[model samples]
Target: MTLRKRLFWLFAPLLVLALLFAYGLSQSLILSRFDRQDAQLLEGEAVRLQNLLEQNLRRNLDLVQSYAQWDTSYEFMHGQHPDYLRRNADPEALSEMNFDFMVFLDLQGRVHAEQWLPPTLTDMFVLDGQPPRSLEALRRAILEQARGLIQTSDEDLYGALIAVQGVPLNLAMGSIQDNQSTLPSAGTLIAGHFLDGERSENLQQQINGTLRLLAADHSVERWAPLPSPGVFSLNRAELSQRHLPNEEQQQILLRFSNSLGQPQMLFELTRDRRLYHEGRKAIAIFLAQATGVSLLALLLIYLGLEFAILRRVSRMHQDIAAIGPDSSQQRLQDRGTDELGRLACEVNRMLERLEQSETRDREILDAIQDGYFEIAPDGQVQAVNRALCNLLDYPAEAMLGQSYERLLSREDAERARQDFALALANNEQIRFSAPLRRGDGSLGHYETRFSLIRDSQGHFAGFRGILRDISEQVAYQNQLLDLAYRDSLTGLGNRKAFSEQLRHALDKAQREQGRLALLYLDLDRFKEVNDRYGHDVGDALLQDIAERLRRTVRQPDRVYRLGGDEFTLVLPDSNSVAAQKLAERLLAELQNAAQIGALSIDFVTPSIGIALYPDHAQNPEALIKAADSAMYEAKRERNRVDLFHPRLLSSSTQSG
Candidate 1:
């Protein structure tokens, strides 16, 4: 073999290998893009499914509330009208409301009436005696929850999801009341919709996916009677034996919990495997095409180029050496009619095309609205787009060599560094929202997505990311939260917030075996002040009173305005004596003349009633009523504080 033959043999294989490597890389990139898109689609679908489940329960709550708030329902609960039950308890009525169970209970938590929809499912709700072994526990749980709802106010109804007999149900409870007639809560009306196999199948059909539910207690007997709940981790062979064909599907698990936040069930969604198989087929075809092209180019090079091209290549190098950055437009002098001459012309055209491509890429980078940045593995800023320079209030030259830490506030930089460390360890992309320091010394909120960059050998190179300003969105969310929980006039926790806090406090006290104090206050002669001082002054005085009440309470102790001249203070881990002392101090504080912008109001007094938990009442609504009754007693006496007592309700109202 001669030198030419040896060179050809070696170079030919090298060329083919390079082509194969390039094809593999391209195919990998395509497959990765598809995988990412599919994952995102699955995640979005999962969120939509969760929202649909929640909305279903909300609709049930609305239906139950509508019936519970009717005057006829109230009269029926109080045993004044039997016709109300005859009309509403019918199967047609229940089916129209999409309710599987409708139970009416008295104030004492006794079931007055109970009916099941599709009435054939009546066997599933047997709570009277010796219910089925599978449903007895669930029936008892539902009754316990219904009794608990009697303590809640009639202001609004709420819904929840519960599991019974290994089946999920949407449950809503409301207090039966006639608001217009001032008819008190006679009882509560509980309604629910059973989530059986058919309902689950309907949900899956709507989302175009396979849905499976797993018991949270690891007792799979109720659903599939599996020996254990570790089926999620079984291998393909093991799953096949169990008749679950998950080999060609991707499973996305969404864990759902009960209202108390205990793990209740796992909802698993399986998506089709078509995208993956299609990607594999396309990649194989690309590899085969790459191989054939590589061989063809090698054959042409060996047969035609070796002898004739070398002499022309040398001459062309000599001509290229004469060109410079500032050189005028020039063409090669040796214009022979061969492949070499055509190659020279193509080279010049390629250089011109390359210049245009670079310009377009630069323009695209500058046109992006969000800030884009690239950082070295050592955390130094390597490059940035035009938007980043403007966002950070720095010139490109100034920002290029600086560290990412400089562009952020101290706290944010520290947090970002920690996140970066975690990302590097996991070798994955991350997204987060945080406050960023801008160039104008003002703070802005940004949602940033950071992706890791790697070299050909899969070594970490650096990071690149995009930052989108979300200051307005964050501000609007916070504003809405404030409006929901804060009183417009007194700047205190409104009724809603106070209710939540009271519920939390009561739960904590019950769990820890502690006590809490509730104090209800009514401003004495408030109507006279509103009449004499005008509404504006009265409003200002109420604001002043709120401040005074807030100041009287210690940290973590809350004060709330329940509309009009009524206020309440919640003291966690307190006794009746502490409650009385705080109430007296609040009354003393209010006695001081409220001077709001030169308007002095003398002789402003508060009638306060003190009630202690686990002493006056064990439930929140009853505790509040006890304190309110005591406050009314104090009101009749004028300028006095009173403690809640069982006998206080009888003679106290007589005096008023």
Candidate 2:
């Protein structure tokens, strides 16, 4: 073959392979995008279903509570006894009221009375039948569950309403009877159904509708309802028996239990292969048509460019190769003003423009101190500048086409996703600070600006933003703040910070009508340590004592080094007994000799003074003075927690 023909043949296979590869990649990308969209839709549906279930359950509970609180029902429950059911009464009075069963339970949780339909009531008249016994057991179980739930639940009135309500009776009996004997006994009674057939039917309809929505293509083979007090259950079986003898079917079985742990409903959902196959066929046809169109377009472009441009370029290259540098002024002759001629002219201009653009872009990128990156919609890194690559310790080529999430620390990925979602939803910029993972497996804190990139049509295309390494700035600010408010020697809150926090705690306690304990701790013989073994040893001993106090107290309690060896602790929501015990524990822990280099320190008991807020003082300064006065008294008593006394406060002021 000639050179052009040989080149064409070699290029043909490569062009075909490239087209095939591109088609395959496009198909995969489309499928992945579709899968993500479908997953999001499914997740939305699940959340909707969860909300629906919660609303329905809450509504049902409210309805049940309302029914249980009816006046007539309350009267019947309180008046009717078990023996009264045996008395033969007119069936018309019972017929006037609509109820499948009327059960009455006393405070001791025993079913003392019940009324049911004639035939069913007669069947359970002896209470020996298996059905009646099972019914009794179920009722008792439900009552016990309700009782336990009410105990821990925040709904205090729910249990009280039910317990106070009376059951309806046919006529006024014994203690319930008054001067209302002239009232008709037939239609005057008020009897309500707690969980009758009508309510159960309505619930069943709702459940079936939900099942249809959830399992649209599946067939329910069998469904059975379970009975209980204030409970509903269903059993469902999928119809998987094939019409043809040789065919196989798939079935899914499900059992639903209520909060009482009783099996209330069961159902089966059978997968329909017809629907599945139809969906698959639609997807396959779509993929095939998409691939065919893409390949055909790519092939036509490749062929047209190859013949009209690539062949002509080859000839121009050979001519240039034969010419010397002296003949560089010689230009290729143009035949027609077709696309290839326009391309040649544009190529010359493009080269000049490209150099200038490249230089400008490089300067701009270099000038930007913050790390800038461009990410595609699929989260792939499209472009990362030098600063970013340097910050992450990754080469530009290595980082490109990598997932943006990989650049964030693993612990911060979820938070990053939330920020990303908010930015995308609002189509606005978001500022977030999180740790970015580096190549060396260390994390550096980065403050990033995430903004949604949109096309001209206003559709979200991707993201383009900058991230700055703010670790040093943040750390320096935190250190400065710590130095201002924290004790330099003991690493506890300073006296000023402690006083502010204590005042806030006192205000909160008074507003909430809660308790607050102020503890003033003055280390015994602490001055002697500084005098005997330098201030360094004293400082180390103080730090050790501060740590011991912190460990001995509850996590919510605050310990502050209130200058020198005197410390103050503010225990919110703590009583005097707890504070005294904590004080004793602190003294015990400090009594042990602290080994600071060669200097062994002992006799480090703290004279703790306790003062109750509102009981001792109304203001922060007054509370501190009261506690301080008590501390002096404790010191006089040789290291003990002295409850503040008015006499002691007065005496301490007089002495001072």
TM-score: which candidate is best? 2
- lDDT (Cα, tens digit) per residue for candidate 2, span 451-558: 888899988888888988998988898899899889988788998889889989988998999989899989888888888888988888988887877788776238
Q: What is the C-alpha RMSD of each candidate to the true structure, in Å?
A: 48.7, 39.0
Taking all chains together, each candidate's TM-score versus the true structure is 0.40, 0.40
Model 2: how far residue 256 lies from native, Å: 90
Which 10 consecutive residues of model 1 have the lowest summed lDDT? 233-242
Pairs that collide in candidate 1 are none
Q: Model 2's lDDT to the true fold?
A: 0.60
lDDT of each: 0.74, 0.60
lDDT of 1 by residue, 473-495 (tens): 99999899889988999888889
Give the TM-score (vs. native) of candidate 2: 0.40
